[model samples]
Target: MGRSREKEDAESRFNSPVSISVADSSVSLLKLISILIIFVVGVVIGLVSSSHIDRYFSFRADQFNIKNIYFAADQFSSDSEKMLVNCERECALSMESFIRPLNLNHRMTDDELFWRASMVPQKEEFPFKRVPKVAFMFMTRGPLPMMPLWDRFFSGQDVDKYSIYVHALPGFELNVSNSSVFYRRQIPSQHVEWGSVSLVDGEKRLLANALLDFSNERFVLLSESCIPIYNFQTVYKYLTRSVHSFVESYDNPSRYGRGRYNRRMKPDIRLTDWRKGSQWFEIHRTLAIKIVADTKYYKLFKKYCHPSCYPDEHYIPTYLHKFYGALNANRTVTYVDWSLMGPHPATFTAVNITEGFLQSLRNNGTLCSYNTEKTSVCYLFARKFDSSALEPLLNISSQVLGF
Candidate 1:
């Protein structure tokens, strides 16, 4: 009986509820600790990821905002084709009077300014006998691969008939002085944004810089990809004899075009006074000065325009048409193929470029008429060429185009 009691007691100890309770408590504690660790790690990762994304978007938004301001200003400045006659006088006279103080003050203060520099004359008589100097204003993002071809064109018999001014990106640090063509030829430039009012500002800035020197009679704005279809001599002769400026004007009714004309342009208070055109142009020195000096229109444009509508296309054309309809040939010298509809024009490919293509583009009779006798041959420059077309153009420079 004593032996049986001892065995039963040992079995009872093994089967007790106290031992089961201890095991359950240990498992529950382990699960809770595991969940805590996972939660902590997840929180840390989420915070770090959120910070990175927020920083990236913030940078983008800042850039976007700056660009928007520029576009709005440009749209506000452009004039509408329909309103050209009514707005031209206001654009010219108002802007000139507004900027006169700034110009006169700058002239009085700075000896190195453009107007002062215009007083100095070349020791040697001007080259190209009868031809006036054509100032090729290069508005570029970087080194032009086609510079060599331009070098050849400018290097022709009468080198002094043409001058080159490079308005490169502000941060592009390269020794341009080494090249004879670009020697002492750098103009002050700011960062230019695509589809922004900054482009109009940049162009105006370029005009101001050119006008300071005064020797630049004809100002032609060319991009990095632009190649001269005719030699410097031909271009110089063409410009000097021409009576009118080459600025394109068209009736733009698109949402981002003339349709966005501000209702708030003071004094006039009419939406019909706005306009639009291509950004490229060849302006006489008189027009260049008028543009730089403009204040009333500039203030109005800067105030009411927006990014939804691009103003560069309308500003110059509208302003020119309004003030100097007789001065402008009413056509752009730069050829751009807008057959393909998009924000950008059709980029010319290597395969598409040929002797035949060149002839066709050159012969295209889109010239604008001023009087019964004179016709301005429409396109002096064509753009958006693939970088590859450079070599072919160079090879045929002499044989094909006389450049």
Candidate 2:
């Protein structure tokens, strides 16, 4: 019976569901809780890591942006300051040129002495000096092929009333002496480059050189290609009788004309007050002095103006407008055509040189204004003519144009 009972117990134990111990159940529960804890910690660590990565990249991007802005601002400031320094140096050099002659009169050579003596202000003399000579200041790059033509024009009956001053390129080795018209009459030569501030400097230097020994009452700036369309008598009479200086004032909205503005010339002056005009001009002795004597306006212009920012187009116009608006005639004696788009003026070819064209150029409207008794005569000189046009211009000098 005992053996039977043991077999039945074994069968029951094997067939029936087994009962787990409390200790084992507790250990399994503890292991499950520990696993859940580990999973939660890993998830938290992943989120934190992702957030840190995003913040680090954002900070780097912001830093890069700031550096770019700072670099741009610094570059602009540096350029502006550099321009200012250059302008100041130029002005000082001009003053030195003017004053050196007066201080070192005996030490200077004939050319230098002449320049110095010319700058010295002459005391107002008795009854207005005999029609003061007009100095035709010519700025040229090479030999003026139109020399023969100019000779004919200048050799007119009243040619004695005027003198010629040629500012040729220093490096040019031309035989100007071959022509009596350009004989030993060359002024001190200097280097000049187109589309550069040196152009402005060259002009000033020419004026200074001419002023040195010549007692010119009137100064007319002209280019190599320029030709007189009127008789010498008419031009001289017109200039001597003029009451105000002649300089053209026009609106130039291009990068070169507009870029000359600066914050340094503010409050008292504004960009809107800025103006532009032809590089050529005709002025009285008094106006010439005013230009040379200027310090404040010149300093401001040179600093803020450049090649991209053509100070030449702005400097003279702005200074004259600001200081001597009343004295200015508000018209340029030099004629230019900006109708065709290019870096240079419209060139008149041989084909374009006709009697009609010459007549049209000489035609002055029959209108009267301040100091004008009748019609307003147009420009004294026209430019950008090809060297070949010299023959056509000379052919019609006396018959139609009266030069």
Candidate 3:
């Protein structure tokens, strides 16, 4: 009877609804706790990933700022270096100009100072900022007795149109002529012998000084005896606006031409290269720079071109012909009447100052390349006029020169 009672109790416990409900409640609670744990783990992982991304961007931003600062510092350093170099150049030019004068204000030895000045134009890299000016360089042995005529010619001209430089005899007195445009135009000069290196030296000196003025686009080497055949306006137009230079370059195979070439000047100046022409030259700035910067041919001419070889006539003509014949006119604008039976041209007296004579110089029916094309008209300047003819020239300046 005790065994039968225990069995009935066990079966009742298993069948009870209250007991089954408690067991189901425990299973649900355990599932909820497991979900909460998974949610908490997901939040921790997302927070760590976001923080890594933020740190990466912040590091990139700092690196970019550092590179920008370096670039700015480099640019500043480069600019400072350029400024220092420019300042040094200016200071050098100033000191050179002060110690050795290429100008007319002070006395100096010829050639070297002028040579240094000429190098500035060639060696320097400068920007062009102004229109061209003409340097009217007068190479005189003594006083310019015809100053009155030149003064009248230069007068009323635009001051910016031209400049003047005169190479006179050393220790020569200016006299009472200190009031004219040619007054303070005297540069330090040395004795110049016709047909010699010294003459070439003098010409180079004038060119060197003129080249200093960047605005001086044209260089006209005139003499104390030279007189302008046209007015200032006409001359200025011819030189400044013209394409070709007025340097008389000719191939003279006569006694003075091929005969003047020395074998020592073989490579630099061959016999076939020997040329002859007038000493006077109206050169463009391009040619002027070349002239001042010459070294090889110049030295050869100085050493070998002597005695019968007139360096003044041969040096420039040959050099231009050999290298720059295309740009040169083989004729001259300065008329010299070589028809006279002598080494010198016909000297004009006051009697020869007729208006007809002046007109003949303007157009002698000879054609030459003007501006760039050929034209029938001719001369613009004349030389070998006696100083006595100044009075008569002044008398006819207004009517004839078209002033």
- Can you give the TM-score per candidate against the true fold? 0.65, 0.66, 0.72
| lDDT tens digits by residue: candidate 1, 1-403 | 9999999998889788888999999999999999999999999999999999999999999999988866765566444332443444455566333322112112122224434433434465643233455778888887776777777887745644666677778777446556567665666667887666777777876676666543467899988888788776677777877887888876667775657777677564244556677888998877877777666676566666656556577678777776787898777778888989888888876777678888767777554564445454656678877788888887777866787
Query: Which candidate has the top score in lDDT?
Result: 3
Total clashes in model 1, counting residue pairs 3 or more apart in sequence or in different chains: 17
Q: Candidate 1: where is the Cα deviation over 4 Å?
A: 1-131, 176-179, 266-269, 365-367, 374-376
Give RMSD (Å) of candidate 3 vs. truth: 14.9
lDDT of 3 by residue, 335-364 (tens): 898997688889898999989988888877
TM-score (C-alpha, index-matched) for candidate 2: 0.66
The stretch of ten residues in a row with the least summed lDDT in candidate 3 is 99-108
Whole-model alpha-carbon lDDT for candidate 2: 0.70
Report lDDT (CA) for all predictions: 0.70, 0.70, 0.80
Candidate 1, lDDT over the whole model: 0.70
Q: Across residues 210-263, which tens digit of lDDT does each residue of candidate 2 receive?
A: 565334678898888888888787888888788878876555676555555676
Worst 10 residues of 2 by lDDT: 98-107
